[model samples]
Target chain A: MNPNPPLPPDQPRFLRLFLASEREVRRTVLAMVPSLADAEDIVQQTAAALWEKFAEYDEARPFTPWACRFAQHHTRRWLERRAIWQRLLEHGLAEELTQRREALRPEMERRLAALEKCVEKLPEEQRRLVTGYYYDRTGIGALAEAQGRSVEAVYKMMQRIRQALLECVRAATAQEVEA
Target chain B: MCAGCDRAGGGGVNFPSPEFDGAVAAVCDGSVLERQAEELNALLRTDAAARDEYLWRVELHARLACDADAILGRDATAVSEPAPVAQISWRRAALALAACLAVLLGGVWLWPRAASQEDIVELVRATGSVSWSSEDGRVRPALEAGARLSEGSLTVEGAASSAVVKFRDGSELTLSGDAELSFSDHGKKRLTLRRGAFSADVCPQPTGHPMVIRTPAAEAEVLGTKFSISAVAEQSTLSVETGRVRLRRLADGATVEVASAQSAVATLDATVKMEASSRGVAAARWREDFRTKPSELWQGSWLPAEGAEPARMATVPHVAATRKDGTKVITQAVSRKDSSAGRIVSLMPDSVLTMKFRMQRSKPVTVLLSRHESSGAFAGNYELVVPPSTGQTDASGWRTVSVPVSSFIAKMRGYQQPPSGGQVSLVYIVCYDAKAGMEIAGVAIESAHAGTSTNP
Candidate 1:
C-alpha cells in the first residue's frame, strides 16, 4: 500500500497555492499592521477566510494577490476595531499607506532578501538574542528578568541591534542594485 | 502594542525621532506603557514615514517569529500553555491506583468514598487509567470513587481512560482520553484544560463573573450551558449541546458566540470557524436474543439453552499469536444481522444496555457499540466495561448487567465523539486473554427517550 496517498483534488490545489503564497500574504499584512503579533493574527484569519472562500477565486489571476487581498481585507476589519488603526482606516490613511508600501514593495523585498546574510554576519551572541527576542516571542520583561538586566536596557540594546540589521540589509540591497 | 489606543497623546508619529524608535521597539517587544502605545498609534495613523519605519521593524519581527526555529535549527516558539503545570507524579499515582483497582475482595472491594469540607468538587466515577494531583505537585492520596479536592489536576491517561467530575453546584466536567485538566473554584469557577477532551455542564454563575476555561488556543467565558471542548496544543474545538458559550481565540482576541448544537474550532493560527454539528442519531430502541447465531463470531459455538445454561453463545478462545512469554488469544462477536446491509439501529443518550453474560478470563469484558451516521458517515465507536468486581454469585456463573448507554464512552480519543442518539451499526462482545471462556445469554437495549424495549 502506498503510505503517501494523494490528497483529494480540491485540497491539494488549495494547499499548494496557499503554502506557496503564505509568506507573501504575511508580508502583505505586515505592511499595514506593523506589530508582528497583530499582523500575524490578521494573516492567520486571512488564511482561514481564504480557504473558506477559495472556490470563488478567479484562477486566471495570481494566487498571491488574491491571498494578499484577503489578508488586507481581514487586516482592515481587524484595524477598524482598534483605536488608532480604526482611525487610520476611517481617515483613509490606511489605504494611502498601503499604496505607498505597494510602491516601495521592490525595495522592501530586496531588503528582506538581504536580511539573512546580514543576520549571518552578526556576532553569535547578538544572533541568538535577535532570534530569541523575535522568533521565540519571549516577553521582554521576562527575558530581562532572566538575564538579570533591566527591561529598558534590554529594549535599548534590541533597538541598537535592529538598527544595525537595518543598515546591513540596506547596504546589501544597495550593493545588489549596483551589481 | 500590536494594535491599541488606550493611553495619552494624539498624533506625533514622527519619523527618525528617538521617542518614535523607542515607542515602536517597546511595542514590538510587548513592554509598551499606556502613553507610549497611544503615541505610537497616533504616529501610525498620521505619519506615512513613521508607518514605513514601523512596518520594516514589524516585517523583521514577523520573519523572525515565523522562522525562528528554522534559523535556530528548531521549531518556533511553542503555543504557550494555558497555564504552565503538569508533573509525572500523576502518571505514578495513576499506575499505582490502577494496580490497587485490579485487586478484588470476594469480587467487589468497596472502598470508603465520602466528600470532605476541603472538596469543592468530587470525582463521581473514573474508568480506565486515571490519576490526580494538586497544583503544587502533591499526588492524590487515593483514586477512590468519591475522590474530592478543593482544587487540583485530574488526568486520565491512555486512550481508554475517562473520569467524571461533579461540582457542589451540580455542574459536571468529563475528561476523556490522555487529557489533563487543572481546576479551582475559589470566588469564581476556573478550569484550565491544559490538554484533553472535556465536556462541561456549567450552572449559572454570579452576575459579573462567569466560569472561565482556558485552553492553549481558546478561552471560554461560560455563564451556564452544556458544552464539550477538545483541547490540544494547536487547536481547541467546542461543541455545544445546549445553551450558549462565548469562545475567544486567545491568539487573535476574536470572539464568537457558539449557540446550541453549534460547533466551533479555535486554532493556534487564530482562526475561529463556527458551523452546525451533526444532527446526531435519531432516537431508537433495539434488543437481541441468541435465537440464532450472531452476525460475526470467532472461536465460538452456540448452546441452545440446554439444562440450566439458557440460550447461550459460548466461546473458548484459542491462541491466535504467540508472544515472548505466552500465546495471545482473542474472541469477538458482533450481535446478529439485525443492523445488516441498509438498516440503521439508533441508540440515544438515555438508552439502557442490558446484557446477560458469563466470562472466565483474568481481564475485564468489553462491550463495543460502533455507529455510523444516516448518510453512511462513520460516527463513532463506544464501549462499556464490565469490571472484574461484578462477581459471579450463582453456581451457573451467569450475570445480568444493565447500564445507561450514556456511560458508554468513546473507544478512541480524537475520533468521532461518544454516542449521542447515533446509529448503531455494530455491537461487539470482546475478550482478550489466552484460554478465555465467554458465554452470552442475551443482549437488550431500551431507550426511554425513543420508546420501550422490544423482544427480538
Candidate 2:
C-alpha cells in the first residue's frame, strides 16, 4: 500500500457531501418556510450559496450541519423578503427552531424511518389523500371541488390522517428504542 | 379550580394536557389562528413539553412535505397494472372507418345523422367571447349556446370567457378562457387541446374508441371519467377526478395509468410521472336537523359572552327550510348592547356545523365558531363575516350554511394553536351586528362523508 494515498479533489468531495445532505437541508429550509414552493426556492438559493463558499467548508467538520447553516441563512433572507401573511416564523424564532432541530437530528431520522412504515399502514384512501396533498401538490380548493367535498372536510380528513401517522411513528420509534 | 390547577391537578405527572395535544395537532396541519398562535408561541418558548410537541409536529410536517413520494411508495420504475390491449386495437380500427365515412360525406349529409353516431358535440353554454373555426380555417363568432359543431376548432378568448360543450353521448367538456381545441371524429374519438385548461366528464366510450385528448407534450386516453387537462408551453398536467386515465408521454412513449384522484405530468423532454391527484377529498354530506329541542341534544347552556345578546327560540312559518322539517326556529335580534352567541358542549371532532338561517335585513352579518375545552376554557375558533352577495337563498328566503370542522382547525392554526385530539367539548356560534335580525331554524352537528349529494 502506498504511504501517501492521493486525497479526493475538494470540489468533487464537497459536491458529494452537499448532495448527500440534501434531505436535511430541505428539511431545515421547510422548517422555516411552511410553503413547499417557497422552501424549494430557498433550497435552490442555499445550494448556490453553499457551492460558492465550498472552499471555506472544513472537511474535518460534519457536512450536514454546515449545509444546514447555509440553508437557514437563505431561509431567513427569504422570510424577510416575503409578505407578512406568508411569513411563518420570525428571525429569532427561526434561529431557535434551527438549533432545536439540529439537536434532534438523530431522533428525527429515527422518526422519519418509522414514519415511512407508518405511512404504508394508512388506509388506501387516506394514503391517496396524503400523497395527493403533499406529493402531487394539488390545491385544496381544486381537490375539494374534484372530490365533491368542502375544503373543510378535506382538511379534517388530512388532520386525522396526520394524527394517525404521528401516533404510529411514536409507537414505532418507542419500540425501536426498547429493542 | 384555577387554570393552573386545571392543568396540573387534572392529570398525573408526566402526562400532557389534552389542550396541548390539540394545539400541536392544529400546528402540524397549519390550521391555527393568530390569537391562538400567540398563546402557543409563548407556551412553546417557555414550556418544555410544548416545545417538544411543536418540534415533533414541525419535523413530521417537513418530512411529509419533502419526502411524500418516498413515503407514499412512488417509484418511477414501478409497474402499473397492464392495460387491455387487444380490445383497444380492434376498437380503433372500427372507429377509424366510421370517421373516414363521416369526413367523406361532408357537413350537410352528416349534420342530420350526427345524433345517431354519438360523435357529434354541441356548444350548450358559452360565456363571454367564444369563437370557432371550421375545416376551411374561417373564424366565426360563437354567438349562441346551442351551436352544433361536428369537427372543427373551438376557441374561448378573454380572461372571463368560457364555453361548455355537451357531447351527444352525454359527456361534458368545460373549456376555460384562452383555450383552443380541435375535435376530429375521423379516427379514434380525439380532441387536440392546443393550450389552456379544460375539464372533461367523459361517458364510457364503445370499446376500441377510447377518447384521446392530446396536448403538446402528452396524450391522455380515457375510457370514461371526469378529469381535467391543463397545458402550457413547457408542461402538460392531467388530473383524474374519477375513473382512470392512461397518459403517454410523446417524447419517450412512456405511459402511466392515473387512477381516480391521481394526477400525472409530462414535460416536453421528460417521461410522464404519476402522482397523487392534487384534488381534495371526495364529496361529503353531513347534516343535522333540530327537530328535537336543542337543549336535549346539547349538554352546555347557551350563555352570552360579555356585552353579547342572548339567543331565543321562536316559532316561524314558511321561512326558508333546507330540510323539510318543522317551523320552530332559533331567532337572534342583534342590538348595540349585545352580540348574539351560544355554545354547545361535547361535539365530535369530525363533525361539521350546519345552520339554516335568513337575514331580515341585508346588513353586514358576521358568524363566528369557537372551540373550547371541556372545562369551558378557550381553545381555538374561526370567524366569518357574511358577504353581502351569497345569493343562495330559495324563493321563500331561507338559506343553508355548512362549515367544516377543519375550518376551525385552520383558523386555530392561523392563530398558531392547532388542536391535537379527536374530540371537541364546546362550540360557540357568535353573530356580530346591531339591529340585524337573523332567523335560524335548523342547527345541527353531523359527521362528514365522502361523495357528492345529487340533491345538494
Candidate 3:
C-alpha cells in the first residue's frame, strides 16, 4: 500500500477552498465566543459541517460567505447548548454581523496584513507585553503580579499598546495605498 | 483617566472611549464584571464607531491569539515566570527567622529569598539517540523524554532520530537526525545550529531579543516564525514556513528577507540565493481579493508578443452591471492573434493557482510558469492548458479553475525541469487561438498542504 495516498482531486480542491476561508470562519466564531477554546471547538464543528455539506455548496459563489454561515450556525448552536454567555448576540444581530463581515472582508484582510507589519515595527517591550497578555493568555492580574505592578497600570499600558497598534495599522495601510 | 473620554469631553475627537477599551479587554480576556458587561452592551448598541472598533479589536485579538507562537518565538505551553533578580546564600539563622515571620504573617513576608532557577527551559521530549552536553561539559549519553535541559547543546546522532527542546517561553525546537544545536538564554533567546537540519516553532520573542539561529555560513534573525534551517559544510539553507526571517550570509554580511513560503541558501563567498520554498507545508495561504487596484497587487505591464495585440486589463468596480454586489474584478481582453499577452507575477513554490473567470469567447487558455536559471537564462517553462469547455465563456456566471503545482511540474517543457524547491518568478495566462475577454476574480495561490504542527 502507498504510504501517502493522494486525496481525491475534488477533495483537495474543496479542501483548498475551505482552508482558504478557514481563518474567516474562526474569526467569526471568535467574535461571538471570546473564549479561544470554545471558539476553536465551534470552528471544528463548523469544519465538520462544511465538509459534510460541501457537495451541496454552489461553487459559483465565493466560499467565505458560505463557510461563515456554517460557522455562525455552529456558533449559535454551541452558545445555545452551553448557555455560556447571556450577552451573546441574537440570531438577527448575528446575521447582521455576518453580512457586515462579508461586506468588509477584503478591508479586514488588508488590515490583518498591515497588522503583521505593524507588529514587527512595535517596540520590544510592547511586543513582549502583547505576547504575554494575548498569546500566553496570561491574565492582567497575573501579569501585574509577575511584574510587581498595579492592575490599573498594566491595563493602562495595554490600552496604550492597543492605541499604538491601531495607529500603526492605519499608518501602514495608508503607506500601502501610497506605494 | 480614559484618554478617549477626556478627548471626547474636550470637543471633537474620534478616539475610542476608555470605558470601551477596558470593556473590550475585559471581554476578550473573559473577565468582564456585570456592570462593565452592561456598559459594553449599551455602548455596542448605541455607538456605531464603537461597534466597528469592537469588530476590529476582536479581529486583531483573534489574529494575535492565533499567531502568538510565531510572533513571540516561544512555546504556547511555556508560561513564563518572573526571573528572580537577586540570590543570597544564608545560614540557618536567616532561614529560621524567615519561617517564623512567614508563620506570624500568615505566609506573607517581605524578606529577600534565595534566587531560584525557575525560568530554565527543559528537554521535555526526546526520541531516538538524543544526547546533551551541559555548560560544564558534562556529557549525558542518552536522555529520557522528560529530562531537564538547561543552557546546553543537544545532538541527535543517527538517521531517523529527532529531539524536541521546549523553552521556558513556550518556544520549541525540533532537531532532525544527525543535527547538533546549542541554545542559550543568557540575555536573548539564541540557538546555534552547528550542523544538520532543525525546525523551530518559535513563540513570540521579547521585543529587544529576537531569536537568532546561527549556522556556519549564515545567521537567521527570527522574529517569531515556524522555519527550518539546515547546515551542511559550506552551505546553510533557511526555509520559512510562516512569518518572516532575515537571513544574513556570514561571509559577506549580505542580508535578505525571506517571507512565508520563501527560502534562502547561504554559501561561503557567494551571494545568498533567495528561492521559493515549499517545505513543511504552508501555515497561511495567499488570496488576492481584487478590491485593491491591479497595479498594487500584480505587475501592471502587459507583454504582447508577436502577432498579439496589447491586452486591455483594468480593475473594474464590478465584472458586470448585472450583479449589484459591491465587488471588483480584473477584466482582461486579448486579441486571438496574440500568443503571449497576459500578466506576470512572482509566485512561491508548491502553490495551486485558483481563479474564477468568465470568458467572452470560448478558447483554450494556457497558464505558463517560468523561472530563471543560475546562468541568467530562462530555463524552466511549464504550461497547463485549460480546454475551451473547461474555460467556460458564459457571461451569465463565472467558472472556477484549480491548477496544482504538481500539474505544472509534470507538464514542464525544455531539457531542464523547473526547480522543485525555489520560487517561480513569472506566470502568464495566455489565450493564443481566440479573442478572449475574461473577467477574473478570486485569483489565489493556495498552499498544497496545511502546516504539520497545530498552533498551541
Q: lDDT per residue, candidate 2, B1-456, as tens digits?
A: 121112222222221655655445444543333233445555666666656667877778789886754665352112222324453334223322332333334422222322222224556555446676766655556334545565778876532346677654456687753578998764356899998767776766768989999999889888878787777775787777678888888888888888776667788776335444443321233232334334432322233222432243332221111111322222233111000011232344465656666666665444444343322223444445556565367675766666555554423222223332322322333333433455555555555433322111
lDDT of 3 at A89: 52
Per-model RMSD to reference: 23.1, 27.5, 27.6
lDDT of 3 at A169: 81
- List clashing residue pairs in candidate 1: B13-B43, B281-B421, B305-B310
Query: Residue by residue across A5-78, what tens digits does model 3's lDDT show?
Result: 55434556665676567666777888777655456556656665675576789989999999888887877776
DockQ of each: 0.09, 0.09, 0.09
Report the error of model 2 at residue B325, Å: 49
Candidate 1 chain B weakest lDDT stretch, 10 residues: B108-117
Report the Cα lDDT for residue A29, model 2. Answer: 77
What tens-digit string does per-residue lDDT give for candidate 3 at B1-456? 111222212222233766567667655655443345445555566567777777777777777765554544342223344322221112112333343334334435323211111123445444346776766555666554435555678887532345666664446676644578988775577888888777676766667889888999888887677777778787787767778889988888888888876667788967445444443322324454344343432432332322422223322221111111322222332111100111122334566777665556777666655443221122344667888667443444667888765576523112244344333434445554334665455555556453221211
- The order by descending DockQ is 2, 3, 1
